[model samples]
Target: MREEDDKMNEHALNPSRMRGRRNVFCWFYSKCLDAAIEKKWKHWNCAKCEQRHNRQAEPEISLQVNHNIAYYEVSVKY
Candidate 1:
């Protein structure tokens, strides 16, 4: 840890770092839980959850790198 831990500091953010660490086989939300659970949706729509939710309601993941660890924690900067 460094002295800066005592205070919030500005840092650049990137998403690529977490992309490599993600489970490629995983879906943001499981298919079984989809609204079409009974219909058995055969194909992924190739959409940003076009069939899932609105743009704003879609979930988001953020990666924060601290000493090479990510998803460790995230915060909003005032």
Candidate 2:
């Protein structure tokens, strides 16, 4: 039990001692989300959402996507 706890603590402290850990998957996902946000914000044409926005002219974009972008922006800074 003591040995196992020591190993776990060592693992936790190693990352802090080193540079840091990067989740490539999450980083890519956030980049894609940022692109989507920029596209929507710029009123650029999106293949999936292009026609939908054009037809309505005034439509509510997904709040969840926007929220995720906001969260990612804050996270990537630090």
| Per-model lDDT | 0.32, 0.33
User: lDDT by residue for model 2 over 1-78, one digit each (tens)?
Assistant: 465346434542111112323232221323324554665643322223212222322335753554535544334553
lDDT of 1 at 2: 46
Candidate 2 steric clashes: 0
Which ranges in model 2 have alpha carbons more than 4 Å from their true place?
1-26, 41-78
List, residue by residue over 1-71, the lDDT tens digit for candidate 1. 24322221232111121112322233333332352345554443323322222233233664444576644
Clashes of 1: 0
> Which regions of candidate 1 deviate over 4 angstroms?
1-33, 46-54, 58-61, 69-78
Between which residue pairs do clashes occur in model 1? none
Kindly provide the TM-score of model 2 when superposed on the true structure, using C-alpha atoms: 0.19
